[model samples]
Each structure stands twice: as C-alpha cells, then as structure tokens.
Target: MSRQEFLVDIVIALPSDLPPERRAELVAAESARARELRAAGSIQRIWRRPGQTANVGVWVAESATELHDLISSLPLFPWMSVRVGALARHPLEDDHQ
Candidate 1:
C-alpha cells in the first residue's frame, strides 16, 4: 500500500487583542510543536509574513484528515484563524528537469 503525499499551504492569523504574555507563551509553544512536526517530516517550511501577524507554511501529509489533525493539535489552534490550500505539482514544473 502506498500513501499519497499532499502539499498543503497554510495561513495563520491571530487575534490582535491577545495579551502580550499570553501571545509570547503561545508563540513559544507553537514553535516547539512546529519543531516536533518538522522532525517527524510533516512540516516542510514556515515563514512569517513581513509587516503582518500572519504566517505561511508548507506541510506534507498522507491525507487531508491527517493534515487537519496535525493543525488542530497546535497549542495556538484555539486562537488561530487558519486557511489551508492543497497544492498539486504543475506539469510545467515537472517537465523542467
């Protein structure tokens, strides 16, 4: 049995009025969780948007259900507004080699 790998693009938004200390705590926890996912090969890369509180990330999972589970497990999940997009390899890119 082969597991299909999916590329997921994620955008994360946090509430603007959250307390500074709480935000710090959440950031710390989220970073730790992200590290775990990276080590497990679930998360590929993450970047913070310039001049914004949002973040963008690339993730890989065997299925959408597994991806949802991973996102929902983040410590900051409760406070985040997230958007996810599934990506497919483009034919042009595939043929570039």
Candidate 2:
C-alpha cells in the first residue's frame, strides 16, 4: 500500500476559564485519537509544542483528500478555527523555484 505524508499544523485558543483538570482531559482525549490513528498506520508522527497554543501532527495517508477528511472530523473547541493546508510547497515571498 502506498502512503502519503503531510505536515498538519493546528492552532487553537486555550480557554482561560477552564480548569487544569479539564484541560488535561481534553489533551487526553486528543491523544486517544492519535493512538487510534497510529494503530491503524495512518499517523506517521505527532508533536506538541511546549508553551505554544498549537499542535503539529504529521500524518501518513493514501491521499490528500483523506487527510482533509480526517481533519474535518476532529472535535475541536467551539471557539476554535482550523486551517488545513498542503505543506509540500515552501511559503516564501521570493520565487525561488
């Protein structure tokens, strides 16, 4: 089976009013999903930045469409906005290609 990889950058705003335990629960739930995907060989790598408000998950899938679908299915916070983009190309102001 052929697998495609993508760098997924997720940005979310942490709720200031939420308790520490609740925040931990939310992280646990997200980690559970990561485990599920990893077990299925769908996730290649996952990384969380410290003192940052975003998550970066590198995923391996069969196609770009599948990746989009996966991101759409995530249970994100109600006030959060997600931005999914293909990460193959470099984002630069100069045309180096």
Candidate 3:
C-alpha cells in the first residue's frame, strides 16, 4: 500500500503548577526533538502561539498512528493538554503551486 501524508496541527499547554525548571527542560528537549523531526522531513514548520504557552505546527506522517507516535515522543507530552487536527489540501493551494 502507498503511504499517505497527513498534516497535523497541535496545541500544547503546560500545567500551571508545573515547576519552572521542569518547563525549561521540557522546552529545550522539545526544541531538540523538533529539530530532529525537521531534519527527517516529518516536521514542516513550527511556530509559538504568541502570548501563550503553546505552539502550532504542520507535520507530515504516513498515518494517524505514526503521527500519534511522533507527538507522544515529545518530552512535554505528559504535561501537555493537546489538540490535534488533520488537514486536507485546498484546491486554491494546488492552483497556486
């Protein structure tokens, strides 16, 4: 079977009672992981949700199961309240390309 690509949108929120030091560690680790994923071409883009302790990104994966694995690998996964969405390509975007 052919592997299909998916676009995943994620939001991460840390617990208010979480320790600052732990937060720092998680952030650093998360950044490193994102870099690795980017290099591997699984992560396309990432941005911080301005004025909030959250982030959003576009990720490409073969399947939702693979995407879940990727997200769960994050160091902050345990502490995060996350929302994920699958995206479909727009006709306009294809025309533009």
Q: Specify the highest-TM-score model's number.
A: 3
The lDDT values for all models are 0.77, 0.70, 0.77
> RMSD to the native, candidate 1?
2.5
User: What ranges in model 2 sit over 4 Å off?
Assistant: 14-25, 77-97
Model 2, CA-based lDDT: 0.70
* TM-score to true structure, per model: 0.76, 0.61, 0.78
Better of 2 and 3 by lDDT: 3
Alpha carbon lDDT at 44, candidate 2: 70
lDDT (Cα, tens digit) per residue for candidate 3, span 1-97: 4344554545666878978998888889988998888899888877777877677778888888888898889887886666667777678998897
Q: Write the per-residue lDDT of candidate 2 for residues 1-97, one digit (tens) a residue.
A: 6667787777777679989998888778776776777788776777777887777777877788887677655555453555555546457735765
User: Per-residue lDDT tens digits of candidate 1, residues 1-97?
Assistant: 3344444444456778988998899989998998999899888777777876667777888777888899888888886677777776779997899
- After TM-score superposition, the amount by which residue 17's alpha carbon in candidate 1 deviates from its true location, in angstroms, is 5.6
Q: How far is candidate 2 from the true structure (C-alpha RMSD, Å)?
A: 5.8
State each model's C-alpha RMSD to the native. 2.5, 5.8, 2.2
